[model samples]
Target: MADGCRRRIVLPREPHAELAAVPLVDLLGERLGFSRDTLAEIKLALVEACLNALEYGQGEVEVEVVAHADAPARLEITVTDHGAGFDVSIVPQPDLTAKLHASRKRGWGIELMRHLMDEVEVHSTPGLTRVRLVRKRKEA
Candidate 1:
């Protein structure tokens, strides 16, 4: 992959816009030869990020995917939004031991992203919030 192997999509903050990540992941899978499992992981993480943006963001959401040219090639995806972002540190961790029905359905997105991707980074401020997901390319 070359440095120019990057695509960016701007989406309206709507529920349907979350589906856009599906085709984007498909393109990445075709171009990078991602494994089925890897593609699924990427898709889930992307959807979660997009949903979060649509739910909390005030304006358009941006999704960027880049395939790096370095050895042991990697894919870097970023989901960003310009909105009144909150403090990530304050989000409570899910208590896995608790019954699913009783547990609060919050804070799982970030945790799921971290669990599925090789690297996950979240940055948030008053005007901008970014979630970065990275995964190594599977060897063919």
Candidate 2:
């Protein structure tokens, strides 16, 4: 691929549709010389972003991946959804103890994305939400 190459994928609002984008990223990451661990982290972060869009969005979901061809290439992924957005600041942190005992254990998507990606940003409004994730290629 050349410098500043971008890949765009649109998935229907269906369960597990987020998985469709994983392989593409995996392939791209491999070609870009990302390590196995880095690739795994990128894939996981991408999954969380896609899941958020699929579960919360009303219509189709759009994923755009940009590979910046620099000395250490990085991937910029943006997941956009058309749905009623919620304030990201209001989301409370997941309590480990409570989650352990609670029957329904979830709500760690944001944290996971933040931990896995170098940068994670959630931009949301009344009818649009965009999750941007970036992971830099680790120096081997």
Candidate 3:
């Protein structure tokens, strides 16, 4: 791994594909000097993104990582799936009060990612969905 490197991984639709994504994050995190807390957050967000891609997406899932050579070293990760997409705008806002009393308790992936990463962008169309997450290492 070099400075300002790019890594891409394509995973099949399997039960443990999400787990497979961990090493990529760990490698980049260690090489890029990500703090323990930041590395944990990135790993969590990546796993959630993979799970969403697997559950709602179709076929295979593709993940791309780019390490930026900047003051803080920005890391951008994109997860893409080939499933039929939906309107990201229509996703309901998560409400703790509502969720606590609801019969079914799920649908927190996007929100969790947003909270964990510095930036989270989701692009979707009729045939594809992509979740992009960006994080910057806090300078020590």
- Local accuracy by lDDT, each model: 0.81, 0.85, 0.86
lDDT for residue 139 in candidate 2, whole number 0-100: 73
Worst 10 residues of 3 by lDDT: 1-10
lDDT score, candidate 3, position 19: 71
Query: Candidate 3's residue-wise lDDT over 60-116, tens digit each?
Result: 889988887677697889999989987878988789889999987888888899899
lDDT of 1 by residue, 19-113 (tens): 78667776765577677878888889888889888888878899998876476677788999988998888877777666366746566888888
Better of 1 and 3 by TM-score: 3
Q: What is candidate 2's CA lDDT for residue 34?
A: 82
TM-score, cand. 1 vs. native: 0.87
Candidates 1 and 2, the one with greater lDDT: 2
Q: After superposing candidate 3, which stretches have Cα over 4 Å from the reference? A: 1-4
Q: Number of the top candidate by TM-score?
A: 3
**Against the true structure, candidate 1 has what lDDT?**
0.81
Rank the models by TM-score, top first: 3, 2, 1
Candidate 3 overall lDDT versus native: 0.86
